[model samples]
Target: MSDHLTVVDHPLVQHKLTLMRRCETSTSEFRQLLREISLLLAYEVTRDLPLTSRQIETPMCAMDAPVLEGKKLALVSILRAGNGLLDGILELIPSARVGFVGLYRDEETLEPVQYYNKLPSQIGDRACIVVDPMLATGNSSAAAIDLVKQAGGRDIRFLCLLAAPEGVARMREAHPDVPIVTASLDDRLNEKGYIVPGLGDAGDRMFGTK
Candidate 1:
């Protein structure tokens, strides 16, 4: 819950990420690896969820068992690329509430421009996890977080496959309360706002788009 960032360095995650970074990796392979890796990332992100004891009858005798406390989690995807992460996470936490925040960067201004947003009515009551495959400039991610805040989202976390130093710094400065969970924190971003040594455009890679 503290203001910080978590980099998942599990072997499986690292291995899958390496494959994803390869330019020769096919679209289908990339998507498959992303799905597989996301499951591992989801495990780390929800590791600290609050739990409560519930009395349940086992096959033998009745006993108190630990169960997730409070409302179901809210999974918010930050548009296009986020959807790729969303699908995989959903497979792991199928009961979680789903939401979306749509933002696209302006080619000239290089700023986020919001286009669409829809969230659960009780977002504030749940622990929200915002998913995006890549955190580049952090402009779009920061803007998405702002919208979540305005919509009554309180306990929020950001999750991504890859992150750049610039993006991480931006998030730390803009929303220190929200923790970041990513697979890899790569080097600095390039002049064009892309993460160095990143897996190209995440959306394009996943969907075979230009």
Candidate 2:
């Protein structure tokens, strides 16, 4: 894929995303909606995955069938919030390898500090999708990607439910080679570094936390 952003505008994805954005949506419903939407987003992210033909036996005869080429794709969740998206994508790409990069923002500096990281052995040879629900400031996301690269991830794409203009710009500058895919690109980040008009604290909303 080109080095650009892809906003998934499918009707179902938009409708489900709307539900997720509502303040009154319950944790159970919000989680369900995120799962539903992530499936559609996965479809778009993997749209151009390379395919190879293999001989298969049909009921009537043997024929060549298309199958995914190379090693199974890798799914790396960017901790807490990313787990929501990860669960859904796993349902669709069940055979994919899994990894996690945990980061928490330092309140004083508003910068990301890595606390945990575990990646697949063959990450460099496989396509890796890093998932997070919100791309608010992009610091943590970029840091997570850097960790993935350090662990040998080369072909990487970022997936998020919502993104702010500031966050998109940050990603563009820091990692232009990594394509970004999201459901919506909101206006901008607020004073506290949250996405404006965004669903409040995706991790808190999805997990019923304060």
State the C-alpha lDDT per candidate: 0.93, 0.92
User: What TM-score does candidate 1 get on C-alpha atoms?
Assistant: 0.98
> Candidate 1, overall lDDT?
0.93
Off by over 4 Å in 1: 1-3
lDDT agreement of model 2 with the native: 0.92
Query: lDDT score, residue 14, model 1?
Result: 99
Q: Model 1 Cα displacement at 164 (Å)?
A: 0.4
Query: Over the stretch 7-72, how does candidate 2's per-residue lDDT look in tens digits?
Result: 888999999998988888999999999999999999988988899999999999999999999999
TM-score of each: 0.98, 0.97
What lDDT score is found at residue 203 in candidate 2?
Answer: 93
lDDT of 1 by residue, 1-210 (tens): 234889998999999999999999999999999999999999999999999999999999999999999999999999999988899999999999999999999867779999999998889999999999999989999999999999999999999999998999999999999899999999988888889999899999999997
Question: Model 2, stretches more than 4 Å misplaced?
Answer: 1-3
